[model samples]
Target: MAGTIDPDAGISAAGEPITEAEALQRLRQSEDQSQQYYAAWWLGRNRSRHPEALPLLLATLRQRRPRDPGAGVEENAIARNAARALGKLGDAGAIPELLAALDDEDDGLREAAARSLGELQATEAVAVLLRRLASGPAGAGAPRLDSPRLQEPCEAMLEALGAIGIAEPGVITLIEPFTAHDRPLIRSAACRALLQLSGEARWAEPLMQLLDHPQLQVRRAALMDLGAVGWRPALEPICHTLAENSLKLIALRGLVEQGAHHDATIQAGAVLSAMDSLL
Candidate 1:
């Protein structure tokens, strides 16, 4: 008997049952806005298999046709999604286009570009991203949101630098000042980035103190970053935080993530008792 090939073998790794050539062609020629958007998005999501998607994505992003006055926000969605896709692709080849995108008029697009540069670990982009950071937080007066992830572009830039984790000679100096930024979220991101870059013993004490920041989001970010850095010296402060209902989940999660699980059940009971004593 002859060997049989699976009919679905043609599908790309991104789960689309189509050829890369076809997807790229559709992204270029499809007249339906929705189809074009999905095709561009697909190219990025499946970019590892289709390294050729970079040029097409860049071209799609460069197309800046003037929109009718009433087109509303959807007018920018295509380019924005393309920028996002480029970032997720993590190709250094896309760095030039992604750099250009950092100055894009749209806030969302600029953020997407900044985020992608970080994903690519584009060290050359550090200067530009830092410039954006220096430009200051865009949401200084905006209404408060519930999560640090909802931070403005400035905060996003700081977080990106942290994600890149490059310990350039001047990097710490630049980021350290932000630790005292007027905005608590920026302060939190700065602290997180600083820890990520150096993990110096000196940071342990200050990070422990920030656990008491007025904003819950700031405290949560501090806990998450502390755990990620595996700072075991923080076990005591983390245990104390577990007594507060609001901080308990993140504190416990941090402790487990840092491998402080010895007698965890007993420690958890002690934490709960501490909570009751405060009642």
Candidate 2:
């Protein structure tokens, strides 16, 4: 059972099917750290629903050890992987662990926790995220921030707030200012949150503009933000964007899903047609 992972094939080892038990075994008892990491990823990818999955992952979230200085990472890899896996699993039970992880000493793990919180749609985290955003490197009313001054965790908080879909004026006030943040990623993230919170084309428009941003990463961020917005009007720009077909398909699918609120059959046909022509 302790072999290589064939991700595309969805097998754990030796081309054998991996059940929930095997993956849990790897995560719980495997001596190889890499095996544990892969097990975590497989659990999340398959969305394992076994009784032990959550507790094992919660334990992994606290697994700590020093990395090889050569690895260029300082935080525990297993914990970070666990944080993300919990998000993908869509279990609200992860909320407490993830919330505490927000204050983690590791920047990367904090970002992972914030992202998972967003995936969980943890409404309880809104005010706490707002506080972190307010104190973040790109905090409101702060001087123009350079690229380094903006952190991925701040973007994660903004995206989390948006994903939770609360429309309080105070939350809007806190998030709107970042739409103009110096970093393109931050600006795109703020725009994404605004669009998700309000369903406004005004927010979607800036994200569309970012599609042509000079940097590929910025453009990719813009595409993802627009996808999260699910603004039907973005279909054209998303189709024509200079990104990979896979990303464009993802954004387009979001449009189809949102538009389906009105008419599913028609929206799917239209989106499929658009993909046929553009992708």
Candidate 3:
């Protein structure tokens, strides 16, 4: 019953065949009051099975204006819904349009576009989103700390990139520059991206270097990422640094948690005994 098409709702009416033209026309003519709302709802609800509807949904996304009391026109729910539907479709074709929408002046629309891009796993959108994160208020450090306008989309993009996996050459190259970015957030993002791109122990060195970063958060994140790589040797330097800094608790914890001991002297004695008990 979940997958059944609802005829009364103007969707797959009569269980009859629908052409692309008909679908597009339905989307276009539904511009008035009631019809527009229904169309938006339908598009958002049925985005996946109806790939043909993508173009229409994209077109509507571009023209629909958000509801503002001052603007007079009823808020275009259909357009908003269509945008969401296109995102749910997860079709790669929608990436370009979604990227264009990233620059939308309307915060809500830009956010929806960003969400759609993430849903689609639009790798091409990665570079654009990263650039935005690196340059937007969050990356650039604006005074408005509480603004969701900057943080929401940037965070979404970061999660999306992480989900998409960083195996692509382009993705790796795009993320590389951010490693040296002035902002720790950007550098951390790059580190995470690298972890996703290549799980190789080679990344351990660079990530380990960040343990000495001025930002404590950066150090912690690097430590976590290093553990993720699970390279036994990589944990040695980290443990030494932690111990030398009087961060013995954290160093001991890292060793215990990872079942890794870098120092031969320490590994041969009670340290191993302590580690075995913890395990």
Candidate 3 Cα outliers beyond 4 Å, as residue runs: 1-26, 31-34, 65-69, 72-78, 136-148, 167-279
| 1 or 2, greater by TM-score | 2
Residue 36 miss distance in model 3 (angstroms): 2.6
lDDT accuracy of residue 156 in candidate 2:
77
Query: Top lDDT: which candidate number?
Result: 2
* Candidate 3 lDDT tens digits, 144-208: 36453343344345435654664777666655665665555445555655754676545556766
| Residue pairs clashing, model 3 | none
Candidate 2 residue-wise lDDT at 219? 81
What digit string (tens of lDDT, one per residue) describes model 2 on residues 145-236? Answer: 54343444567778889888888998899888788777788888888888888877688778989999989878888877776666777777
Q: Quick one: RMSD of model 1?
A: 11.0
lDDT of 1 by residue, 136-195 (tens): 433331334654433346655766787788888677777777777766756766776776
Off by over 4 Å in 2: 1-17, 65-75, 140-152, 261-266
Candidate topping TM-score: 2
User: Would you list the C-alpha lDDT of every candidate in the order shown?
Assistant: 0.63, 0.75, 0.55
Q: Provide TM-scores for the models.
A: 0.62, 0.84, 0.47
TM-score of 2: 0.84
Report the error of model 3 at residue 51, Å.
5.6
TM-score quality measure for candidate 3: 0.47
